[model samples]
Target: MITFEGASKHYPDGTVAVADLDLTVETGATTVFVGPSGSGKTTSLRMINRMVEPTGGTIRIDGEDIRRQDPAVLRRSIGYVIQQAGLFPHRTVLDNIATVPLLLGWRRAKARARAAELMELVGLEPAQARRYPHQLSGGQQQRVGVARALAADPPILLMDEPFSAVDPVVRTTLQDELLRLQQELHKTIVFVTHDIDEAVRLGDRIAVFRPGGVLAQYAAPERLLAEPADAFVESFIGYDRGVRRLSFFPARDLSPHEDTVFDDQTRAEDARDIAEGHGSPWVLVVSAERIPLGWVGTDQLSRVPAGVPLGDLDLAPYGHTFNIGTDSLRAALDAAVLSPAGRAVGVDEDGRVVGVVSQDDLGTAIWSVTE
Candidate 1:
């Protein structure tokens, strides 16, 4: 655990980078520091590892004052990842990840083996181990940075905007990878980011810092979104916070209807009757193996010959499917909104269609949960 007791960082010119802040980062959990630029989020993160010395108060790790330890040794004991990877351009991926272990006096062979293990742990293939930093993609470089940090097996990890350099798709994949790693490693993580969405997604607790290094609010992601500490936090979270809150609630509670679903070989006339019987304007068509085919409109069904099968007609795209057992309500809502038939398809783990839920039903479920 990390404890900040009235810690403050003041420059020689009287600029306050961090105020007398008091915060506690729990063990084995991700605590995200987030706010606008110059809000001192980065400054606060640097204080944990003594990268930025605090001019006032004190900071402690595991109940021991950080000042009692040598700055160099203290830093070596913590895992730190920064923007754009900050890797050695001249070093191979294996050597980059082996840096910390080698510094700690591990044998070269042992360190290299540990680096190889971390490479797979962070989703990098063994084939990339010999490649230089410039040889890998931006996402791959970040993964190497993560592997390098974890190479020494530090109990605490500090990440300063690590995923900010990548595109949205890669950023999300990296975020998911981090979450997966955290579940297994259980490192006490302090992550810094300006993006509230990223904070909400990865943080077990979020600390919102205001300008002048003031700690505005520190709470769990769900509470932070539901109850902002001030106008600054509310505005920073944006107007879509309600939608964002839906991420916490599970979609498993939602009841998906299978009455409007039909087999691809089902006759158009018969499928139309089933859809209309259920008061649905569209029917979901699935293949013999129960995989989602697409959506067939009642109008289209009527136009086709009565004996024609749903597979014979050009069906509208199903848009996407949400794993009802694992996904959240927000995911279901997104699927429903994008679907051509205005319904979300819920699938099982094997990608087989389980059922479908209309937007109206999803809204009802959301309202029930939020209320």
Candidate 2:
């Protein structure tokens, strides 16, 4: 919903902060401007809301040029969030969040109602509304800043390193929260940051600016990670992109076998018969109550009376021992890969074996990264 055409910023001292920027941000997509300090990412974001007026070219919101509208009116339509929250220290959290709506002449009660709802929206409790910004944690203050920017239901948002001031854990939580909000609200956003990883994680499209305020590469995160536009872009993404690619790998790719499983109560003689019938050498052993007991070898049976119990043998498969519900792709792949029998068992929240994750399953999952 935002477009920059031949946009450049000069301070009248012959120093150009940005030059000849030409980019289009699609409606409702989170477009990130990522580069090092003095690379013009923040400058570009400010130019959108008329916070920094372009010296050379025009910025258009939707289709109309932003210069045509009053700066205050344009800013009111587009939410602005910055580092350190920019909250008014003397005001209560709810009062701070209601600032923008109040500026827009919203009724005091309605603006406050919206502010209270926003507090809950950002995972803050209602009690926090009455407290001052200084009383809240750093993360909480940032959320209040977000709520303040969003108080008026703006169609667009300009975020200038909004999450950068917080701790790493809180930054992650805010990023995830913003992503969830985007899934629902779909507001057009232009976010600027120096952190490339954050750009890749949160952006639908990333515009990487180089040293001279030049656009290096702009593409989706997957394409940018798999194939960068140049050596500089590649180096910027770093070698850990292979690790980051795991986010796209789903549980479907790591499919578990749904075949019948054997428990400890299963006799080795019967297991041998089942294995031979299926043309396999071993079977998954389970308890008498239908819980996983591990795998039993067909040839390892000694002697057993008709209904006599079979004692627990050595756990042959590493997959049989590991839990699965919350396991990462790497851990699940490792269990099957490191197994002597080349198979991993996937257990449910309970200890019972739900399915088997075999070498084929692991290979198939890895192959998905390419295809």
Candidate 3:
């Protein structure tokens, strides 16, 4: 656990970066510090490892005052991830991840072996081990950075907007990867981000900062969305707080229609007959293995050449699917909205199509939670 007792940072020019921060970051959970520019979120994070010294009061990790320890020694004990990844330009990916272990005097072979293990752990291909940081994609470099940080398996991690540099798709993927890692490692994490949505998705507890480093509100994402402590926090969370809160609600209450799913091997004439009976414009196409392919328009099936098999026809894009047993209502609703067929594809653990839920039904599920 990390505790801040009236901790503050004041620049030599009389500028305040953090002011009287009194909070407890729970062990083995993620705490995110989020706000706009000049709010001092980054500064507070740096204070944890003494990268940024506090001007007054004390900062303690597990009851030890961090200021008393040597700065370099303290920093090496904490895992830190920055926005740009900060990999050494000339180092091979494996060598980069093995840096800390090498510094700590592990044998060369052992360090490289550990590095190779981390590469797979962070979802990197083993072949990338020999490549340089420059040769990897921005997202891949970020994964290497993560692998390097976890090389020594530090119990506490400090991340400053680690995924912000990537595109939306890559950012979401990285976020998911981080969540998966956290579930296994259970590190005490202090993350800094300007994006409230990222904070909502990642934080076990969120600390909202205002200008001059004032802590506005610190609470769980659900409470932060359900009740803002002040106008500043409310404004920062934006008008979509209500919609965002829907993420906590499960989609299991949604009643999905199973008849909408059809096996790909079905006869085109039989599929056309089934489509006519359902009166829906689109039928979900699935493999014999029960995996979803895409949606086939009924009208298109009718126009197909008589001798051509149903599998020979092109399919309309299927947007995405959510696991009804695990995914949140927000994800299910998003799948519904994105689908060309006007339905969310619900899947089971094996990625097989279990059923389909309409957008109206999803909205009704949301209403059930909200009411």
Clashes of each: 0, 6, 0
Local distance difference test, per candidate? 0.95, 0.80, 0.91
The TM-score values for the models, in the order shown, are 0.95, 0.81, 0.81
lDDT rank order: 1, 3, 2
Q: What TM value does model 1 have? A: 0.95
lDDT of 2 by residue, 256-308 (tens): 76453666665656656666676555567666655666565555653444453
Candidate 1 lDDT over residue span 112-212, tens digit each: 99999999999999999999999999999999999999999999999999999999999999999999999999999999999999999999999999999
What's model 2's lDDT at 208? 93
Residue 65 shift from truth in candidate 2, angstroms: 1.1
Q: Give the TM-score of candidate 3.
A: 0.81
Task: Please estimate how well model 3 matches the true structure, expressed as its whole-model Cα lDDT.
Answer: 0.91
Candidate 2 residue runs with Cα over 4 Å from true position: 12-15, 258-354, 358-360, 368-371
Worst 10 residues of 1 by lDDT: 297-306
* Clash pairs detected, candidate 3: none
